[model samples]
Target: MTATAPLPDTAGLRSRFDAELANFLDRQDPDWPDGAPRGVFRTLHRFVLAGGKRLRPLFCYWGWRGAGGADGTPIVVAAAALELFHAFALIHDDIMDGSERRRGEPSVHQLFADLHARSAWRGDAGSYGRNTALLCGDLCAAWSDQMFHECGLSTDEVHQGYRIFSLMRTEVIAGQYLDLVSGVGDGSVASALTVIRMKAARYTVTRPLQIGAALAGAGADLMTALAAFGDPLGDAFQLRDDVLGVFGDPAVTGKSILDDLREGKRTVMMALARDSADRNQALRIKTLFGNPGLDADGAAELREIIVATGALDRIEQMIRVRTEAALAALEQAPVVPEAREVLAALAAEAVDRRL
Candidate 1:
């Protein structure tokens, strides 16, 4: 039996990641565009620096370590680039979803909207905010590429990492488009799973690991092994996120429960519930699920339908199964012992957390 190494100091990684972001942001000449509004920079900086679990960067770090890379600034900077990409994703996602809050604060678009309102800006306040936020998201995506390229890795390593990074960016944006289209028609578990695979699983976990491994000059076989572990774990993470979106406490989750129901998120849980619900139950869900003005009473009914149809239970089971699969893969993977230990713990935290 292989002995798993003790978990590394993740808190230390978090601190270093935070500092890297701050230093990078500080060095940027916010006034470089001359007369262009500075608020966009400030907003992006705040949004990026603000509260987040920094999960992707952590995964990248572990992947690099697992691939036998020594602890160094270059790898840390490379890993931190994933966080910038995630910030881009979140900013765009909030705009697309019309989410009012993120991490217990006003979302980027909402914050800018409020700014427009306060200043009595000409034209539509909401439109101005949305447009500005969109530009900011674009900037973040561009900056992510820039940071990833600028990291002090060998030319070959940088080239390899970029291949993975570019693919990740493309797939995630495509997945977002698919998610939007999926909301238009009858929700199917298959469609939802497709979105999860592209947007959540591959972008969130698999590719980050691959990118880090690439930076470490890991070969094809090792990359395949990491994907085997990462993909399933990512699925379980997103499934847990789906459950939390509807059932989790807003105070803890830092998101309103109503947002998912109001947006009619075509999550697997909703698909299963819709599929299994009887006539009236289905009708009740159909009527209330997407209603923006749906109140607590309607939400109670919707929750009841979800529970009664056993979708919630089934999703829980799916999380467990996928998590176990990820852990089992880790055991057989060629990653360094410490990476196995940390990745194992991360799998549990990703699926079993309340927030």
Candidate 2:
């Protein structure tokens, strides 16, 4: 008799998680009338399967493993649900930011807009595109909940997962609102950091870990340790993302260099630059930072300003410090051996990645 090979830790889990999504999408109910908008499902399938780091799911899976949950399919299914929720977030985020591209292709709204234009359908192509994408996002959110509820955990386990799930969804939406509100008034470093904590820190790492830990029925001590590790790592991750948004190669990052500056994202990097700029440099920034017509020259000038003010160096140092703190917390936590190693590696990647 031949023996089956053991699954390779997280990589195997990711592949299986992706396969679950594909299988679910492929098996959708065809009994629905032909009048049903099947194209929306198709579009969502492509969007969810397309390029992403799958960071949230990875954190979730590791969190489950770290909490002494036995290797099985249930945890993986739960983790994949986070990806669906993330799809909802990204779809709406692109529309909100008016982003043209994501993962090196037209964003969901942009894709719909292009389709409308090419097909010569409807009254207003842009509005149609936006509305269609909004529906798609809402569908993803609904699907996330559906997937979570159907994962076949025990009733108590499901209830636990739901608590984390509900709280996470609420926090991210509230964080996004905070982000939008910050754009209108004062663009201080403190406000930007607050946005980072709510939007990126908790949603990206902390709550996902907590959700997985909840699935395993982890104790308060373990949850606290995970939060201590996740908070700093997530903060560094968002800070690195801000840096990449402005300074990274478009080919490498698959995002426009000018989008954040154009949208006036009010990021920590920008806040630090504003804090340190001289009078004329400050005026130049005030004039060009949020200008819709900010061209390459303007972007280059902004980049130079950020660099000259030492904000980039300061932020880099902050990333290093936060990464060290996360690693330290991970070292002290009583997590399983393999999970500890994987999470430690992920911490470094989260703070120091190029894309």
Candidate 3:
């Protein structure tokens, strides 16, 4: 067999992505028409650059390589565009969830709200903040599209990828809608899994991978193979995130451990816990799980209930199974050996993380 090439430098790629993102933002007209507020642009700059795992871009880059696309500026710029879209999703999601922090800093809406309060602005601070943040999210979405199209790739490659990009966007929005309804609807594991598949699974991993592969003119079979690998990995990824949301340290996660419980997110873990809870445990969960004013004691009780119900253990098992399935799929996928090795490592990192 021919010798496999060495693995690409992921840390260097991450730095390049960050630099490309910063440069793209810097090129935008932050100050326009003499009266437009620059704070929105400045905030977007900080929020995008502040912190992120950059999982989406890395997946995209690997997918490109797996499909025989060469390393170059075009792929890097295109992959980085995904980060802008992620910022849009996160900014909006935080507003919907009423989250106070992200990546160890004030969330976009909270920052704007605090600014309004501190400036003693004429409008309701909360409303002003939400509205401004909404605009900022919209701006990020627009920028993502612009950056992707202008990434210096051939028109055919960009066009192929845009189709997948559009579908990913639609699916995530639909999933978000389902998530809102699921909070009031039956909290079944099936429904929760549906949300994961659409909202996080496909959006997070599968679509990014497919978009990259498509850009490289990959055939349908390879695209399907990447999906097989990405879907399970993405499921495991979200499940781990759910665990961290409830159990992770704020200093480590840069998010409040209480926020998930407070929002009563209809996660698979919560659904499983509800399914297995005992009588008093069920009652306590009903009382405290979604309570906006849930305190430390209530959160502690909920954690105990989740553990006693065996929900935590079940979720962990699910994560392991899905992670294994993803790796198995990756092994069979018709990708370069170097890509396969790196992807297997990524799968482990995705499912086994404190953050």
Off by over 4 Å in 1: 1-8
Per residue, candidate 1 scores C-alpha lDDT tens digits across 113-232 of 999999988889888878888888888888888787878888888998889888998999999999998999668999999999998888878898889888888889889999999999
In model 1, state the lDDT of residue 313: 98
Where is the poorest 10-residue window by lDDT in model 1?
1-10
TM-score per candidate, chains pooled: 0.96, 0.96, 0.97
Candidate 2 ranges with C-alpha deviation above 4 Å: 1-7, 29-33
lDDT of 3 by residue, 1-355 (tens): 1223444688888898999999999899643447887899889999999979999999998888888888888989999999999999999999999999999999999999999999997979999989999999999999999999999999999999999999999999999999999999999999999999999999889999999899988889999999999999999999999999999999999999999999999999999999998899899999999999999999999999999999999999999999999999999999877888888888888898999
> Which regions of candidate 3 are displaced past 4 Å?
1-7
Report the Cα lDDT for residue 139, model 3: 95
Candidate with better lDDT, 1 vs 2: 1
Which lDDT values do the candidates have, in the order given? 0.87, 0.86, 0.93
Pairs of colliding residues, candidate 2: none
Ranking by TM-score: 3, 1, 2
lDDT of 2 by residue, 106-211 (tens): 8899999999999999689999889999999998898888787777677788788679889989989999999999999689999999999988888888888888
Q: What lDDT, from 0 to 1, does candidate 2 have?
A: 0.86
Each prediction's RMSD over C-alphas, in Å, is 2.4, 2.9, 1.9
